[model samples]
Structures are given as structure tokens and as C-alpha cells.
Target: MQLLEAKLHKIDRHNYRSYSSMRGEYTFVDFDFFIDTVQADPYAPASRVRARRKWALTDLAWLKDQSQDYQRAARDFIARQFADLSQQENGIQIDRPGQVILDRTAVVFDEEGIELRFRINLPADDRKIIAKKAMNLMTFTMPKIIRRSTIARELPIEEMKRHCEAVEDQVALRKQLEENNLLAFVADGSVLPRLAGNVDLPMANAIPFECPAELAIELDAPHKGKIRGMGVPKGITMIVGGGFHGKSTLLNAIESSVYDHIPGDGREYIVTDESATKIRAEDGRCVHNVDLSPYISNLPMGKDTAAFSTQDASGSTSQASWLQESLEAGAKALLIDEDTSASNFMIRDERMQALISKKDEPITPLVDRIALLRDQLDISVLLVMGGSGDYLDVADTVIQMHNYQALDVTAKAKEVIATHPTRRTSEGSEILPLPRTRQLNRAALKTMLEDGKFRIQVKNKTTLRFGRELIDLQALEQIADSSQLYTVGWLWFQLAQGKGWEKQPSKAFENMLNDDWFRTMPHYGDLAKPRAIDVMAVLNRMRKADFK
Candidate 1:
């Protein structure tokens, strides 16, 4: 045992805001002293014994670990040093690895004491480490403290674990929301209305429809591709595309999206409209020979007179009546394909077309019908048509089901709109400076045609072939740089039919028709007759004056 004249140095006066620490050199001067000569104080000092930290740092923390009793000796030494402090206010205080400080009887001292000092070794391995830790500590960062405060240079392992857990919880909640399948339905035919109209969200429209971000389904060949869903208005939406292009599949999938059904049946999306009536038809039965009398009146037209029926007595007056009843039944949307009409145009013809129009009165007819259904009934129509049908003329927005899925046909729509000239017409336009109306005026053609330039055709036999007219050849050559010229020829041919007014069908015209205008324009193989016929109808209606 050695005794020394003990002396202490105060290194720092300002106490650390949180846990306290101190340091001072302990130099033991061993000297002779009789065991019986010691004197004790009258009263053991009122101050309690406080746990002391190591003032002098050794060369290595684990230097003593090399010995056989390394762990036991080190632990026991620390225990003896803190033995007196444990009985003080509450417990002992001691430094642990990884910068942990435990207090109370569980580990270390309890009484809150002002920090005495921080020892600095002139040149030692711990100097840099201590300095690094001191520099990293930021004071006054805790918002809950409200005032100035200080924390350890490093955060506690437990606090860090808790912080990471909180962050993970937040991430998990977001993922759950994404997985929640917001589709509108239940197995019982119910509807979970959408929250908003984001294109990525399942619920897109305010009514019942949802704009889908990525809608994909496995279908038979010729119908492989993603079917995108756009936001539908409160009114009808038309999906027009060519045959064998997966239109019906898309419609069926849409129905499935509402209610989760099997792939061929339902179960894709959960639709809550269990009570909602779905009048879908497959094969020919209901679609092929539907009785118009159920919905529209059986008008006594001589051709359809095999079964005598009263027009007034019938619940339905025409094919339009069937559609009308569906609308009246509070049906959200009508999905129709080819061969539904009694008359190709409609039962009431102009009347039916007028009822489905964007507006009423002024338009030839469609505008009026569109206004009635959209404004009054709130029912939407999903019509699938081939070729540029009359319904396309009134459609507010057309979503085509081409390439086996749904696509917005806005480009085609805008092209048709651009062709439709209003009152304003520039002087150099190829499309004639038309009047305000979109439909070509049959009366105007009679006034403009001269006897010499006119070639009349009766019974439509001699009117198929038409030559191409040059329209800004410089632009045409630029566009046809490397691609084929199918589209280019079609455009010029339309111009020729409209302005040139062919007097005779020429061999050159046939050659040009067969030539490659552009590889892109639709191939007219089996579809050639229909394509040719549709083009001629437009040509016959267009006047030479319209091109001027």
C-alpha cells in the first residue's frame, strides 16, 4: 500500500448540460505510517460518496485483457471503485463500452452533481478520440427541451433503435395504402367509390369510373398488351377500334375491375355494385336476334311485318328505345358492339342520332341526344364502332381499343376537328375555306360545278378510282424521306377527288393507288373493299369548292 499527499485540479467550471464528467492526475507517494496513529473526524462528512470516473487513461482499453484473469480483474476493480457510491443517494455511476452511463443501484451513482473537470493528456492515444467525440456533440438540438441543453457526443443504442423503428413504421403504412386495392366493388356487387381522379389511382372519375395507371391482363394471342384506363366524364365514353383487337375483352376486364372475379368471369377488381344489373352478351343469342318490342315499339314496317305488332302497344318503339330503357334504368354505362341496330342508322334514324348529340337543335342531330343523356339521365355510353361511324362525329372523347387494349384516340379526334373549318379560313389552305358548318353542303356543289369539269356517276359503278393531286410537293417529299408513301398518296388522292373532280378513272390512278404511300397507313388486304367504300362516300359528299 502506498500513501500520497493528494491534490485535485479543476479542469472545467461549466458542467455538461446532461451527464457530468471530471478528470485529475492521482500521484501516490508511498510512505511509512503506523496503523494505530490514524485520527478520524467527529462526524462522517454529510456529503455522500460519489462514483468517480477514470482520470488517467491507460495505453489500451483491453491491455489487461491479455492476462488470464483480465475480464474478472478489470470488472472487480471497477466494482470496488464504485462500491461506496452505490449506497449514496440511490446508486453508483460508471462508464460502459459504446459510451453508455448507467445510474442508480442498478449500476452507478444517483445524486446530480455539477461536473468538476475534463482532463486532457498532453500527448496520448485517447486525446484524439476524446477530441473527436467532443467536436461531434451539438448542444441545444432537442426541441422538447425548449431551452439550451447538451447531449452525449454519440446517441444511445436504444434511442437510435427506437428512431429507426419509427421510420420503418411510416414506410410500412404507405405500402399498406398502396396495396389496399381501391377498386369499386365487393363479391356481392358493391362499389367502393374512388377518392379522386388521379390517372394512377384506381378510382379516377367522381361518378364510378377510375383512371388506372397500369391495367394489364393475360389474354389469347392477338390481344396481348396493357389496357390503359382514362378518366371518364359523367357522360358516355366510346371505345372504338378494329375487330379481333380485344374490345370485348377490355370491356369484360373493366367489369371485372369493379368486382373481383375470375379471369374469364370476374374477381380482378372488387366492384361493390352487386345489385347493379350487367346486361352483357356473348356469342349470338341475346346480341344477334334481340326483340326490339321489349324496349322500342315494333313499328309495322313492311319488311319486318312477318310478326304483326302494334307500334303504340309495344313497350319499345325502335332500337333506340332499348338503349333508352337501359339509360332510364339508371345504368351507369352502356357497352355496345356491332349488329345492335334494327336500322343500320337507328330506329328513328335522325331522331336517335339527335338524341345522342353534344348539344341540341343546331347540330344535324347527335348534339341534341348527347345533351339529353348527359344532362338528364347521367348515363354514359360505351360504344364500339368500326370505320369512322356517325357516332364518332358527336363523341366528346373516343377511347379506341386498338392493338388489343384501350388508347385515347385524341390524335384522330383532333385531326378530324382540324379538318372541320370554322368561319375563319386562310387564303392558302388546301382544305377549302369552308363555311361555319362541318358537313359538306350538297347544294353548294351544284352551284360550283361546270358542265365541262363534271363527271356524273349513277349507281356508284364508275366512281372508285381517283388520281392524286400535288399538295405542297416539297413538304410531301420531306415527310416521305425514307418511309413508304401510302399515307402521302391517300392525302393527295383525297385532294384530287375533292378539287380535280376526275372525269375518268385512269390507269395512272390505279398505279398510284397500289404504290406505297407510307408503310404506316392501315393495310387494305381483306379490309380493302370497306376502306375503299368509306373513302368514296366522303369523296362523293365533298365538293371541289370545299378544297379551294
Candidate 2:
């Protein structure tokens, strides 16, 4: 601490650039502080720093003995606490987590102690350093915030326990999905609607979800005991309803349930298969070497779709590419909503088939191949459809949402199929081959970084600027946080370090994203663990990427 103060004193009234000399480690009375990076000016990005307190100092060392999930939740809870406390000061900031509890580096736990990674904007008067103000912030305010967040007594003990337990329980529930032959579970009383289109908070006075008795199943959580919820069965399940009837709302909840939500977030008990991917029509997106033969075999001028590559794709082609890419990335279940999907890609009616004969039309819709995916590839699909009754013929389960309530309509849908049978013949081949793994060119990634001076930037959750390429990721609804995107860019940076092509990029990423994923990267608090599927999805969106 004296060292920090002395340096600040020497730089008092000096140019802001002098602050760079203060970058180093300092030993405080109760903890150790590290200024990893220094800002060049007051308006530049905040300086990165870390405060680590030994386990013996914090009565919260018991967290070290907990399960990995429990420990991750505890760390997230601590980071949230620090963020809340630091909000009073404009210059101090931490990477705050959202409703989901992701494995993040904002707060890390090692064998020795708990470390809090955050940013600090050095105090300045115009372009000159303000030594006294910097001293107060670093030596007094920051230390207090660090101690309160790390110490057990300073925290809400019961609230922390509940937070950690809820995450642990959600993890347990998700593990039970495969054994129960389920794709997702929505516990009774979960609030499905958010406050608005842009807001992610639960809406006030919203109708709570209720599982129809026919689809109700019980799963045991270590902390919450048995939880009864709607178990969306494996295979093709359709959610059908009128406009504003909460059909898309239900699908949104299930898609977000792939990650564990914080307590009282309204969907805390809801859980879905971690490998579930939500894919939609992303028109104008780039497609690289994807096999779209099952859905689109023949094209104008005898174009080959077996190794499809397009700089700009149509809605139907983009959707097909996403589906095939998700399969290659090891997606076990797919979630789709008709509102965001391409009509032509989802289905082609008998009238259209008759008007344009199969010989002339080259596109094969998803309706023809959903059953093939379920039976041959062992993949499950949950779709929200209102326009197409054609899917009823192949659906294993049907649910209808009426005025925000769910009703089991599988029997009714079967009855409808019997009374009003469709004349549209299935358009695709009977057998669906598993999507082949595409090798990624590591040289391309490295070249991109080199061309752009090795820069990685994230814009909210919608865009990633890796090297010189700006990739659009607005269609990836399952990315829980922007921090995950930051991790994705760094993961690609590691992959770019190797020479030649990566034979199995998805599997390689899966192996890198294990329990010790963050250990290999720079110690930045903004990094959060991302799913392998999302990592590959981001890479697939990069226009400059080369895949074969």
C-alpha cells in the first residue's frame, strides 16, 4: 500500500501518462493488489486490476470444498456483490452477471485465496493525475469493497446459500433430462414472459406456468427436493397457438433454460439440455462448406450443395446451413419459432408442390426431414408453429398455448390428423445422414488476427469483432452473456496459434472448455465460459473463416 501511495505522490500533477509507471503489484495490510494494465489517458479504457485475499482472511473458505457448480455460483454471487457496491463510484466497475449463473473469471478461487478482477479509472484533473483522489479510491474505497464481498459475515449468508443452492439444483435437473427422455423441463409457477422485448427481467403480474397433468414429471434437486414441471419429451414436439398467446414466450423460456438462472429470476427451476440450440432464419449471413443436401440438393445451373459456400444466403438457405452446422457442433436438440423462421424452409403445402413439381423445385423443406432427424440422427426438435398443420402428421407431442396457459394437445392433434389428412408428400430422402465434421483452417484465423493487429472486441451479445472481421451473432439466442463472447474470441485466439487445419474443431473446443478452461487465457475478469456449440456457431458466422 505504501508503494502505491508513494508512486501516486511522485506522479502528483504529472501528465496522465505517468500513471503507466505505477503498473505493478502492491501488498496491502489485509490483501494483495495488482495493477495489470494502466490507462494512458482519462478517457481511455479503464485500467485492469486484481485484489486477492487469502483464504484464511475470509471466513468463506468453505466454498473451496463445495462442488464445482456450487463454487461457480458462489463466485458469481461475490462478483455481483462487488458490482452492486462499486456502482456508487463512477470510476469503479466489475463485470456484472445477468440472470444466468455462468462460470466466469470476474471472481476466481484458487488454492490460496479468492481474487476479484475488476477495472479502475485512475482519477485525473483534465489530463493531469490527482494523487490524493487516486489514493482514496485505491487504498480506502476499493479495499472496503473487496473485504465486504469476500468475507462471509459481510454478505447476506442465507441469500448467498440460496443462490448457490438454486444453481446446484438447476444443474441437477438438467442432468436428469436424458434419462427421462426429455428435452426441457419448465417447473410449475415459473414466469415465462419478460418485461418487454428488450428487457430480460420477469414481467410483473404475469401468468405463472402450469404443467398439464399429462406431461408433468418430477425431478429431484439436491437442495430444492422434488420439483414437478412440464417435461417436453424427446422427438418432435410442436407448440401451436394464436397470436399473442405465449407460444413464442414458452419457447424463449426453454431456450434460455440451457443455462441456470439466478434465484427469483422467475425461471430458476426451469432447465433444458445443455446441448439444445435455438436456430432461426439469418438471411444475408455467410455459409462456409456446409452440407445442405438434405434440404437443398439441386439448384440453378447445377450448383453443388454438398459443400455449400455462399457469401450471402437467402432465408431458407441460411436456416438450413444453421441446422447442419448445429448438428456438426453436437447439438442434441433444436428449438425453432415460426415467427423468426422462413415459411418456405419450414414447409411447402400440397398446392405449392402441385403448382411447382418436385422436378422443377430444388428446395426440400424441414417438414419432410424432421422425422428423419428424430429417427435416424436421434435428434429432438421443439418447434413453435401456427401456420402449418402439416407438421402434426409427424409430431410426437403437441402443446397449445391459450391466453398464456399450456394445454396438452397431442391427442387433439392426432384426431385432427385423422380427420384432415394432408396430401403433401414428403420431399426428401428417407434416410438422413449425420452431418460430417468440417475441418477449420487455423491459418485463416491467424491471418485474420495478424491483419487486424490481434484485436478482439464484443458489442453486447449481438456482434463480435475478431481480428479484421465483424461477425453477426444476433440469431444466437442462447448466448447468455457478452462475457461469453469475449471468451469465444480468446478461444479462437488459442486455436489460431496452431499450424495447419484442425481436424475436429468442435471437439477440440469442447476439450478446451473443461473445468480449467480459463487457466490458459489472460487473467481478464470479463471472460465467461461459453458452450462449445456457441463457440462453433460464432466461428461459423465469421465471413473470412475457411472450413472444409
Best by lDDT: 2
Tens digit of lDDT per residue, candidate 2, span 255-336? 9999999998999999999999999999999999999999997799998999999999999999999999999999999999
Tell me how far the alpha carbon of residue 108 in candidate 1 is from the true structure, in angstroms, after superposition.
66
lDDT of 2: 0.94
TM match of model 1 to true structure: 0.28
Write down the lDDT of every candidate, Cα atoms only: 0.28, 0.94
Model 1 regions lying over 4 Å from their true place? 1-232, 255-259, 262-267, 270-318, 343-368, 420-548
Poorest lDDT segment (10 consecutive residues) of candidate 1: 141-150
Off by over 4 Å in 2: none
Top-TM-score candidate index: 2
Q: Write the per-residue lDDT of candidate 1 for residues 450-505, one digit (tens) a residue.
A: 33243221212222212222111111101111111223234333334443333322
Return the TM-score for each candidate structure: 0.28, 0.99
